[model samples]
Structure formats: structure tokens, C-alpha cells
Target: MVLLEHPLHGAGGREAGPAAAGPGARGRGLVPGLSLSRSLSQQQQPRLGRRDFRLVSSLATTRKTAGRGWSIRALGHLAGARPRVGPARAVPSCMLGCAAAAAGTSSPPRCRSRALFRLTAVSDPECSGFWLKQSAYREQPTVRFRYEVLFVATLGPGPGSLLAWSTFPAFNRLQEDRLRVPLLSTREEDKNQDGKMDLLHFKLELPLQPTEHVVGVQLILLFSYHLYRMSTFVMQSMAFLQFFSPVPESQLSMNGDLKLNQRQLLHHCGLDTRYNVSVVNGTSPFASDYDLTNIIAAYWDRNVTTVFSDPNPLWMTGRATDAPFIINATIRYPVEVILYPLKTA
Candidate 1:
């Protein structure tokens, strides 16, 4: 973002006093070479004076016009010629010129007050699987096992006077997917010691079962400004990232006899594998037996803690189950899997 400073006016300089009075001003206690009281007395003196009201009126008009010109110039300088990334457009040069000319005339334009706020765009790099967890099943009936993960982020104070947080609606779902957690909480922190607030946080939650597989995830982040009266200013700063797992393809299928490819496996599991893969499984019938393979990829598992910290702070931890076989042991099928970035508005 660009920030411009305005020059200070009326600083360390001699100011012009009231305009010189004319012949008419003499009648109103305004005159050169005479004290104000004496001038008033002379105007009231019996049978003695001629009043030049037109001359006094002209002086007042000149003073008012000069003051107006000074004010207009100051405003024009403060509102730089360039346009920022907000709703307001740049003030036309012609308009400013017209105002200057008017201020130089006898009838000066009235002053109007206006307020403006600056916006800053900020975000951190995407952090991959920061949390992981896994658990084994004993004799539990409700759930045999569970898996969970978490991500964290940290944001600093903005460079502008006013700061606010807003998420891009189009990228909200993608963020949830990449983080592998439900959007639960958000908070702002004051980190600059400027006696002001600046910072944001998001919390997510996810559940996993021992019999399920791991698949890739995509996420995105958007930044904007929130003004008073429910108004908002959109920004261009955005972030995107994808997560991947290290599991081999041999362990991604249901049976040892299925010839499931990555593409087909992901398709059967309703997942995109080109970008990130969490789980995959496929089974095929061979000449004399059945073959199967399963694939799984993820940043964290039941034993690790993942923290996503950069733009903001997010903590995630979870457990996951191994790829389990399908109920139909002898069935043969083809599977395909692909993962990539999701489209953004």
C-alpha cells in the first residue's frame, strides 16, 4: 500500500494582519495613522466627515477571498492526485483548479468537512499439516479408533490507521478443506504496542475413523477492511496452498488383488488427488486371484501436533485409521485419484 504525507501549513512564518481599512472603515473605527478610539470619535464628531463604505467593503471581500484560496490549496495537497484501492476515486484536477479560481474571486466558497480511512493488505505463507494424531481401538463399540489434526496462524498490526478482518466468501470452503478442520473460532491480537488492536485467529475441528483413508486438501485466505455502518473495503491480498501425504500406492486398495490406479482410487473415494491425497483404495480380479492396493497421504497423524502460524495462529491435532478392505472381498474395480487447487472467485 502507498502512504503519502501532507505538508504542514501556517508553520513558523509571519502571518498577514487584518486587511488595511478604507475611507468608509474610518467611520467604523478602522483607519490608518489614527488610533481605533480616535477614529471612532472622529466619525461621530459633529459636522465633520465623509464615509467611503465601498472602499471598506472591498477590503473585507479581498481578505475573505485570500483565506478561501489558502484553504483550498491545503485540501488539494492533502488529497494526493493518485487513487488508492478503495471506493473513492481521485479528485479531478479540473475541479481543484475551479475551486482555486473561485477562492481567488470576491465571493469565496464555503468549507466542507470530509473523512477518509486507509486500508492495508496482509497475510502469511500457507503452512502444511501442523498437527497430527492417531489411536488404536480396544473393546469400544461406538468407535474403534479416532484421528485429529490442527493448524495455527499469527497476524501483525496493520500499517494503516484503521484495521479490520474479512474473509473471501469464495475461498472460505477451500480454507476449511486445506486446514482439515471446522471453522470454530476467530480472534484479534494487539502486537505492535501502539495502544491499538491488530491480529486474527481461526480454529478448526475434524473427526477420523480407523477404517477410513487419507486424501489431499486445498485452502485459501482472503483479507479485507470493515468500516462503520456495516460497510467494507475489499483488498487484493490472498493466500493459497495444498497439502500432500507420503504414503505409497501399494497400501491404498481394499484387497491385494485389485489393480487400482491413483486416478481411479481418488474418483471412487470422491476426492481430488492431484494436489493432495489422504486416502485411496481399489480392487481387481486377476486370472487366478484377487489383487488390491490402497494409498494415503497426510501432513500429520495421531502422534504429532501441527501448528499453522504465520499470517495467523491455528492449532490442530487428530488421529486417523488405516485403509480398511471393502465388505465384498472378491469384487474387482478400477479407481482413479487426482488433487489440485480449487477455483477461486
Candidate 2:
């Protein structure tokens, strides 16, 4: 735990002194009375005014300053210069009446607090061929707060199908392994009571592959989708896209320098052939696209003099005619892909 010196440490360190007497000091341990004791030199006394006296009095009543040595130097600093002596008075009856009035005992019942439900979708509506509209609350006060909700979806059966899913990376890096999505909450509802509304909500989306059997699409519901909470603060939400695909049996050969035909080269490198090639595109269209052409070329030129150096070069044929070769071709597409930003109240 972090610790710091108390603001009143010096005051509490002073010594205690005998109680002073007279009109300026009266009524030992009584309300509206002055009890002055000095344990320190004048330089160590805490100079206080009338306002400070009232504040100190309130502090004394609240038991915040007791036992902690605090010195009062003079009563002349108080306003009105009134005598300190006073009767041992009971708390005012009117003050007690005021407290009772403010107790809220007779107020009419009302919804004192509100519970909120929010729905957020992250998708490329144009590519996904669907726009999402939440049946839940329309909007919420854009506050920074964390919450959990369920996520559910229904999939149409097909040979090669794509579905929207969400995952959190173990860390911020994209390549890190993902942990299973957490479950938040569950509920059962039957508005019609005919079993038509029966559904199970999930807190996370599960990626499901295509199946042979035909199944009619139905509503998928998620419950308790967890989200970071913020209150008037900016935060970032990172989620992973879950995908399902058939795995290939054989690994592709990365034996030697690869040489691709012009069309294959351009497509693989994500370059528009119509555009002029420049340093921005790198030495080769595909190679430049990934900022890897120079490095791959240098490595290939240095180590392997013939296209037949390895069992199977990526793009180069084993024939001597194809000597100069390319290895890994990486490309960047220009199109921007935007996913919906999830938001909650």
C-alpha cells in the first residue's frame, strides 16, 4: 500500500498544555465552550480564526481531532468576542424536527434506479448482406463502463459458409492463441407460452462449420456479452474474428526461390497491373507489395545460384532457363475493411 505523510502530522506532534480559564475558555468538555491547552511554543501553535474555531469545534464533535494534539493559541481571534461559557444544552428540538422532515419516510413509491440492456453488432453490413437493428434499447448515454452480454447466432447450412464470430486474443498481439469465450448469464422467456420462444442465449459466438444436413435458419441469441466499462473515458475493444475452414493434408513446399507467371504474380502480390511500378511497389510488384522482395531476392541471390538448388522452389521451375527466382510474395490490398464498433450504455 502507498503511504504519505498526514497533512496534520505537525499539528498532532505538538505537546498538550494546561487548560486556560476565563470568559475566553469555559465549560470543560461542553458544547459551545472553549477548552484551550498548550503543549508547544508559540511558533508551533496553529493560528486559527473564528471560522477555523467553528470548523475545529465540528471536528471535535465528529471525533476526528481527538487524541491528535492540536493547539489553540488565543480566543481573541474568534468573531464577536463572546464569552466561551455556555449551559450544558440539549440539541435544539427544531433541529431534530428538521432532521425528521428530511428523512423521506412518506414519499410516494417510484423507480429509483433503472437497469439497462444494450445490443451491439460488429460486422461489415455490405459484405455480410445484412444490417443489424437492435430490439433492445435504442441508445445509451455514451459513458465508459464495462458490462457483459450474451451473443447468439443462427447459421444457414451450406458447403462453404461464412459466419460472424468474436474472440479475444490472449494478449494484444494478433497471432497469440485465443482462450474460449466466457459465459456471462442465462435466462428463459416464453412470451407466447407455445414453446416457440424457447431459446438459449450464449455470452460468446461459437464458430460452426458447414454440415451436410439442411437446417432452416433460426434466431441466435447471446446473453451477458462482457464489455469494458468506462465513465467519460476513452477505451479500445479488441476482438478476434473466428473462422471455420477445411484443413489441407499436405504442407506447401517452400524449398527455393519462387517465380510466378505475370498474372499469378500480380494477383498474389495484390497489385493493380494497370498502375505503374515504383519503389512504393518494391522491386517486383508482389515482392514490393509486402516490403519483402529485396530481402528475399538478396537471400536467394546469395545462397542459390541455380533454380534447382532446392527440391521445389516456390515459383521457379527446376529448368536452368528459370535461374533468377522469387521466394515468398506478400501483398497488401488497398481496400479498407471497417467493422462496427461495439458500444453500450
Candidate 3:
């Protein structure tokens, strides 16, 4: 039995009930040639910690100047028992648009609302997964990345003139005698002691023949990336690096950041595992499945990816004729500010 009033229109204007607002009197709006109508949800007791309870309302106004109709819909969340009736407060315009996405229905061009409603418990900690005890979104993700390495060093620019190695047994099998295993070591560090790794220290030494001289380097590192927030996003991503020089290089040192790259917007709510697949089919028996060209092309086609951003990679000359080509790399995973949409219960 609550009465609602428009802010722009004075108390002398027409009023509407809580449950239903019928067509208002003519010339009810602040505008000279406009009419207004509004409807509000009936009060009800919402089930606690269950499915969401949406308080739906709509306003439709006709404009004589534009010869059009404008519609506006609002959605409020109701939780627990029936809300206690109190003084009504004006809701911001942005909050009114909260239900617009859920409504999916609009009048011609839509109308604006100057109505107000007393918003009670709009969200519940237990139902929204934000404060749940076992919820993944309760804390920062303890990301565990599985890694695989692949490399190709070109001795010369001519075709079939490169040496390659891979951690994949099938890929190594396909390489046959051309396979060159390097001495590799890796270690991860938690800089701030927050139980999450901050960076990885990687070193690799590839033995070379006295006549071999490396003029180009290509490397691929695959990782299983994920985020547990509004949505549990799981994906297999890669950091691809390529460097070429006319002169033979002694060593390559890289300090880079492996950051997430998103092409399409992720879902506001749901589990997203669309890219949860191996970047390279390690168990495949065919050589085409392990082709670098095919792998890079497929990885880029994904909506989400990881890239290695190294603005300054040091390439030192002078191999000393017998020293193995060395690769020293430091890849850091910096903290990122993720903006996630919160759902009203």
C-alpha cells in the first residue's frame, strides 16, 4: 500500500501503488507534451540462499514532440524474508538499468524514470559465492601451470636448414636424428610470500657442432591458465617468441612478462572452458599435428591467449666456435587488476 512519487513532479502529481501502477493522468510528466505510466513489484518473502528473487518494474512514457514511446525497466534483488517497510529512497539512474539486461524488452527508444523504491538486502553473501567458505572467488587463485617447451634454431635461411627440439615424445620421435636435446633447468619464486608464484627462472644450453652458427631462434612455451572469479575460466595458452638476425649470435637473454590477452568479452556469470584444450597434441602420431605454423595459427584463433612481451631482448655476438648456444630467460607473472561484474542476489 506504499505510494510513489516522481522527483521532478511535485507532491501534487499523481501517485501509484506498489503492486501495480495503471496509466497515469494526462500531462503527468515534467515535459510539456508527455504522459507517464509505471509499475512496481508486489512485496513478497524471498527464499533464503536459493535462486535469485528479482523485483521487476517498468515505466513507459509517450512523447508528443518526438512522436515516440520510451520504456524503462528496473530490477531489484530481494533476499530472506519480506522487507520491512520504511522511508523510500531515490535509486540512482545506473541501478535502475541493472534490470535492463535481464528484461530484454523495451518500448520505442525507452523512457526515463524519476521513481524511487526502498532497496533492502539486494545481495546475500552465501548465495552470490563472494563470501562463501568453499568458493573459489573467496581468495586469489592458486594457479598451477603445467609447462612444455619447444624451440627451433635456424643455422641458415635456406629451407629445411633448422634444428628443433620439443618436450613432446611424439614430436621428438618425428624429429628422429634431427632432434637436439638441450640442458634445461627451471625454478619458480614467490616474491611476496603470498603462496603464489611471481616469476620463473629458466636456462637452457644447446650443444652445437663447430660448423653450426645460429642466425634465428623460435621458441614456444605452453601453459594451463585459469581464473576463478565470476566465472571459472580454464584455458591452455602459449607464449611464442621469435627472433632473427643476419649475423650469427652467441647467446640470447630475455626478460619478459607473460600476460593474458583477451579478444572477446568473457561471460559475466558461468564456467568458461571454451579454450580448455592442449595447445599441441602431444600424443598424436602424425607430423602435421606438431607443425609450428599450424599450432601458431590455431592458438591465435582463440578468444583468449597468453603472449610474451619483451621489448628489449639482448642478443650477444661471438660464439667462441666451441661454446654451446645459451638461452637465459626470466618470465614474470605480474598481478593484474581484473574487473568482474557482481550479481545481485
Which model scores highest in lDDT? 3
User: What ranking of all candidate models by lDDT puts the best one first?
Assistant: 3, 1, 2
Model 1, 1-345: lDDT tens digits are: 222121111112211111212233222211111112232233312211223222222223333222211123222322322222222233211111122232344322221221122212223123212121321211101100011111222112222211111132322233443322233444444455443334334332323335333332223332221111111211111122233333311111111211211121112123222332211111212211100111112322212111222322121223334322111111111121222223234
C-alpha lDDT of all candidate models, in order: 0.23, 0.22, 0.58
Per-residue CA lDDT of candidate 2, range 102-144, in tens?
2223221111111111112223222221223221211111111
User: Weakest 10 consecutive residues, lDDT, candidate 1?
Assistant: 139-148
Off by over 4 Å in 1: 1-183, 193-197, 225-236, 248-345
lDDT tens digits, residues 1-345, model 3?
222232222122322221122343222211211123322222211211111112122222322221112212222323333323233443332222212222342221122323333222243232232233331123243344466988888999788788889888898888877789998888888889987887778788989999999998988887777676567788888778788999999899899887877666565578988898989888999999888899999889997787888636899999987799988888777654444444537
Clashing pairs in 3: 70-110, 70-111, 71-110, 71-111
C-alpha positional error of residue 321 in candidate 2 after TM-score superposition, expressed in Å: 47
User: In model 3, where do residues sit more than 4 Å from their true spots?
Assistant: 1-145, 339-345
TM-score for every candidate vs. truth? 0.20, 0.17, 0.60
Give the C-alpha lDDT of model 3: 0.58
* Cα distance off (Å), candidate 2, residue 34: 4.2
> Which residues of candidate 2, in runs, are more than 4 Å off?
1-59, 62-81, 84-161, 164-345
